[model samples]
Target chain A: MKAIKVQALSKKYGEKEAIKGIDFMVEDGEIFGFLGPNGAGKTSTINMLIGLLKSTSGTIEILGRNLETQKEAIQAEIGVVPDESNLYPEMSGIDNLTFCGSLYGMRKHDREKRALELLKIFQLEDVKHKAFKAYSRGMKRKLTIAAAMMHQPKILFLDEPTSGIDVASARQIRKMIEDLHQKGTTIFLTTHYLEEAERLCQRIAFIVDGKIVKTGSVETLKASLHDQSGLLLKLDQNMANLKQSLQEELKLTKVEEINERSLKIVWPPDQELTPLFTFFRQKEVHILEAKRMEPTMEEVFVAITGIEHSEEKGGES
Target chain B: MNKGIALLSILNKDIRNYYLKPPNISWGMIFPLAWTLMFVLRSETEVDLIEILPGVMALSILFGTTSMLAVTITFEKKQKSFERLMLAPVSLYSLMLAKTGGAIIFGILNAMVPLLLGIALTGLRAINWPVLMGAIILIAVTSTFLGLMIAVAAKEVFEAQTFSNFFRFPMIFLCGLFIPIQELPALIQPISYVLPLTYGVDLLKVAVGAEGILSVFLNFTLLLVFSFGLFRYSIHRMERNWMN
Candidate 1:
C-alpha cells in the first residue's frame, strides 16, 4: 500500500496560496524526501497530511484511508514529529513516553516495556528519570521522536529532524533514519539539508514557491543537469589572462577563474576533452589536475530553483 | 471505548504535570481559608457560620478550577505541547473532556480541605449533602468551561488570567457570595440572573438551609444548563483555533 498519496492538494492563507495544487506519492517502506527551503509550503503540505490544517482543495489518502473522513484511523497509524520538540518540560522522559503510549491504548506493562526499550535505543536510559527541562537539545529532539514512535506507527513524518543540532547528534539521527528505513518503516522526511536528502531518500521532490518543480531519484536529477555541468582544473601556475584567453580560445561562454591556479569551464556532457586540453596547453595554463564536477544535491537545487543555498534559508525566491 | 481510555490518559498526564503541584494546592486552599477566618473574626453581629461556609467552599472551587484550566491551556499552547494532543488518535471531544475534567477533579479535591476544616472549627453542617455535591460538580464544570473559553481567546498565560478574572471578579460580588442578591441595587439585580455563579451560590445556600433567591430545582436546572452551554461554546471556540 502507498504510505501517502496527495493529489491537487492546495492551501491558501488570506489571498496567498501556500501550496498550489501539489501532487505526490510516498511509497511504503521508502524514505521520501520533500526537499525545499523554509516557508516553501513544505510545512503547509505536511500539516495538511497530518490533519492539522484544512486543505483549501484536493484529496489525501494515507495508509489507504481517506484523510478527510478517516482522520482518526490514519492518525493512529502515522507518527508525526513536528518541527518543534514539545514534550512536557516538567515530566520525566519515562513519564512522557508512558503518557503518550497510554493515549494509543497501550496496556500498562506493554507501555512500560516499550518506553524502556525506546529509551535504551535512543541512548536516553541513563537520564530517563530526569525532567525533560533538564535534557540537552539533541536529547529533547530524540525524546520527541521517541514519543511519536511509542505506538509503533506504520508511517513516520519528520520535519527538519536534524536541523540546528550538534554534528554528533545529527550523524546519529541520520544513521537512525537509515536503520528505520532498513527495518521497513515508511518515512516522509522534509529537510533543507540537501546532502542529507541525497544520502537518505530513494526519491525526492523539489518544492519552490509553493509548487513542486521536480520529483525524481538522485541519479535522474543529476543526469538531467549533466549537460550543463562543468570541469574544474587546477593549474601549476597562475595565468593572468586565463579567463579571457580560455573564453576566446575554447569558444566557451562560461569560464570562471577560481583563485590563482584553478579554472572552471562549462561544456556539453558529451563534448570531447582533447580540444580543451590542447587549448589549455597552447595557452601554457599547465593543468596539474582535472576533474568532472558531478553536481551535488545543493548544486542541483540551485540549478533548478535559481536560488543560492544561503539565500534559500530566508524562504523567498 | 478508545476515546474513554484516551481521555483518562490525558487527564492523568495533566494532573501529574500541572494540577498536583504543591503551589497549586496551597493556592487553592489559602484564599478560601483566609477569607472565612477574616469574616468570622471581624463579625460583630451573631454570625451564622453555616450560612457563610458554603460560599467559602464555592469560591475555593470556582477559583481553583478556572485558574487551573485557563493557565494550563495557555501554557500548553505557548509551549506547543497542545499540538501533541491534537496529533494523537483521540477525538476532540475526548481531549476537551480530559482537560476540563482534570481541572474539575482538582477543584473538588482542593475544596475538601477548607470544607472539612470549616465544618470542624465552626460547627457547619450540610442540610442536603447530595444537593451540595451536585452543586459542587456543576460549579466546577461551568467555571472550568469558562476558563477554557477564555483560554481559547488568549495566546499568553497572563492574558488568560486577566480574561478569566474579567468574569470571576464580577461573579464574586454579584453572585450573592458576600451580600444577598435581593439587597443589591435595583439596576444591578438583572446582572446576577445572568451570571451562572449566582445560581451556583443559590444552590449552596439551599444546601445550608439558608433562604436563597431561587428554588433548589430552579438553581439546579439553571446551573446544569449553564454548564452544558458553556462547555459547548468552549468546544466551538477550540475548533476555530485548534492549531493556534
Candidate 2:
C-alpha cells in the first residue's frame, strides 16, 4: 500500500487558496521529497496530509485509510515533525520522549525504556535530563524528531528538517534520515534545499504557488532540462569584436554573454565541439576553459519553477 | 493503542509541564489564606467565617482554574505543542478533558486551604460534608470549563487573563458571593442566574448552612448543564482551530 495518496487536495483560508488542487503519492519504504521555495504551499500540503488541517476539496488516503474518516487511526501509524519543534520547552528531553510514547499508549516501563534507547541513539543521553528550552536549536530539533519517533511510526513526515541549523547539525540529521530510510521506513520530506532533495529523495515533486509543477527522480528532472545543454567558454581576453564573429560563424541557438571574458553557447548535446574549437583557434581567442555545464538540481529547480531556491543564494537563516 | 492511556498521557504531561510549576503552586497556597485574612479584617462585627466561606472558595476556584488555562490551552496554542497532542490516538473530547484535567484538580486543591481554615475556625460538624464535596467538585469542573470557553478564542496568555477577569470580576459582584441575589436590582438578578459561578457559589452556600436562594437540585443541575455546555462549545471551537 502507498504510504500516502493525495488527489485534488486543496486548502483555502477564506478567499486565499493555499493549496490549489495538488496531487501526489509516496510509496511505502521510499523517501519522497516535496521541493519548493518558501510560501510555495509545501507546509500547507503536508499539514493537510497529516490531518492537522482539513482540505477544502479532494481526498487523502494515508496508509490505505481515509484521512477524513480515520484521522486518529491514520495518525496513530504516522509521525509528523513539524517545521517547528512543537515539544514542551519546559519538559526534559527524556520526559518529552516518554510522554510522546504514552500518547501512543505505550506502557510506562516500555516507554521509559524506549525513551532511553532513543536518547542514546539521538546522541542526547548526556543531556537527557536538561529542559528542552535549554538545548541549542539543533538539539531542540533532534529531540523533536526523536519525540515523533517514540511510537516507531511506519511513515514519517518531516517538513524542513534541515532548513536553518548549523552545518554539522544539518549533516547529522541527514545521516539520521538516511539511517531511518535504510531501516525500511517511508519518509516524506519537504524542503527548499535542492541539494538535500537530490541527495536523499528517490522521487521528488516540485511545488510552486500551490501547484505541483513537476514530479520525478533526480536524474529525470535534470535530463528533462537537457534542452538547456550548453558549452561554456572562458576567454583570456575580453570578447572585444569576437562576440559577433563567434555568433555569426557558429550559428549558435543562443549565446549568453556571461562576462567580459566568457560566454555560454547553447549548442545541442549532439553537436561537435571540434568545429567551435577550430573557429576559436583561427581567431586566436585562445580557449582558456571549454566544457558542458552539468545542471545541478538547483539549476533544474530554477529552470522548472522559475523561482530560485533560497539556499542557492545563501539566503538561509 | 488504548485511548484511556492516551488521555492520561496528556493529563500527566500537562501537570508536569505547566500546572505543577513553583509559581502556580505558591499562588494556589497563598490565595485562600490572603482572602480569608482580608474578609476577617474588613468586618467590624464578629464575622462568622462560615458565612463568607462560599465566596472565598468560589473565587479561589475561579482564579485557579482560569490562571492554569492560560498556561495549558492558550500557551500551548501559542507554542503549537497542542498540535502535537492533536496527533495522538485519543478522541477530541478525551484530549480536551485531559488538557483541562490539571486545572480542575488544581481548582479543587486551591479550595482546600480555605476549607482547612474554615474547619479550624468553625469546625466540620456544621458543614454538610457530602453536599460540600459535591459542590466543590462541581465548581471545579464548571469553572474549569468556563476557563476553557474564555481560552478558546484567545491567542495569547495575557488575553486569556483579560477575558477571565472580564467574566470573573463581574461574577464576584453579581453571583451573591458577598451580597444576596435579592439585594441586586431586578434587572441584574436575571444576569446573576446566567453566570455559572452563581450556581456554584449558591451550592457552596447551601452546603455551608448559609441562606441560599437556589435549591440543591437546581444548583447541581444548572452547574452540570453549564459544565457540559461550555466544555462541548469550547471543544467544538478548539477542534476547528486545531484542524486548521
Place model 2 in a CAPRI quality band.
medium
- Considering the two chains of model 1, state its CAPRI-style docking category: medium
Report per-candidate DockQ: 0.59, 0.76
lDDT of 2 by residue, A1-317 (tens): 88889999999988999899999989999999987776778888888888778899999999999999998899899989998889988889998998899999999999999999988887899999999999999998888999999999999999888867888878989998999999989999987677888999999998888999999999899889787778898988888588888888988766878999989887768777898989978987888998887677887888888976654443421
Please identify model 2 stretches exceeding 4 Å from their true place.
A234-264, A310-317, B42-47
lDDT of 1 by residue, A1-317 (tens): 78899999988887998899999999999999997766788888888999888898999999999999998999888888988887899889999999888888888899999999999988999999999999998999899889999998889999888877788888888988899898999999988788999999999998888999999999999888887688888888886566787788778867778888888878766898899889877776688898888777887988887778887653422
lDDT of 1: 0.85
Model 1 — TM-score against the truth?
0.95
What are the per-residue Cα lDDT tens digits for candidate 1 across B12-75? 8888777778788678768777867876676553346666777887888888888889999999
lDDT of 2 by residue, B153-200 (tens): 788889988888888899889998877899999999999999998998
Estimate the lDDT of model 2: 0.86
List per-prediction Cα lDDT, in the order shown.
Answer: 0.85, 0.86
